[model samples]
Target: MAPSTTLYPRATLKKIVKAHSNRPLTKNVDILVFLNYTLFLQELMKEASIKSKQSGERGISARSVRRVREHCLRKFKG
Candidate 1:
């Protein structure tokens, strides 16, 4: 199973689901379309990584970028 879905509170999750109910992620659909294209996620993630690196942010790491990119790609392709 997936991690506990408590990432968001029950109410907030409900709102998010109900609000985008029409465009909800289908069982077989990749979640990239939850916004638009998967590449957008890749680019944004890269940009955030660059920003954190420049700012000397301590916690963020390059592995996060690769993980997010791969997750998005896999979700979209499969």
Candidate 2:
């Protein structure tokens, strides 16, 4: 029998589904979701599609990234 080859933790299971899709995501939401949920690229795509509008893309800075990362790590890092 072969051992499982998955590398990501179970907390990241949602991401595998996301990445399977070929559609790409905008960078703004990409950073936000990753900073907050460590979710897969596809989940970020779903989030952005629902939340974003015709505007080019949201501007996200390093400070905001750090803040979100901290919040996720503290709140959802379980």
Candidate whose lDDT is highest: 1
TM-score of each predicted structure versus truth:
0.32, 0.27
lDDT of 1 by residue, 35-75 (tens): 34546666657665776677677656666565466555665
Q: Which candidate is the best by TM-score?
A: 1
In the range 2-64, model 2's lDDT, one tens digit per residue, is: 887843454353465357655664535444554455454344444444334333346543444
User: Counting only residues 3 or more apart in sequence or on different chains, how many pairs clash (N, Cα, C under 3 Å) in candidate 1?
Assistant: 0
| Model 2 bad stretches (over 4 Å) | 1-37, 40-58
Question: Over the full model, what C-alpha lDDT does candidate 2 score relative to the true structure?
Answer: 0.46
Give me candidate 2's TM-score against the actual structure.
0.27
Reference-based lDDT, residue 66, model 2:
41
Q: After superposition, how far is residue 38 of candidate 1 from its true place, in Å?
A: 0.8
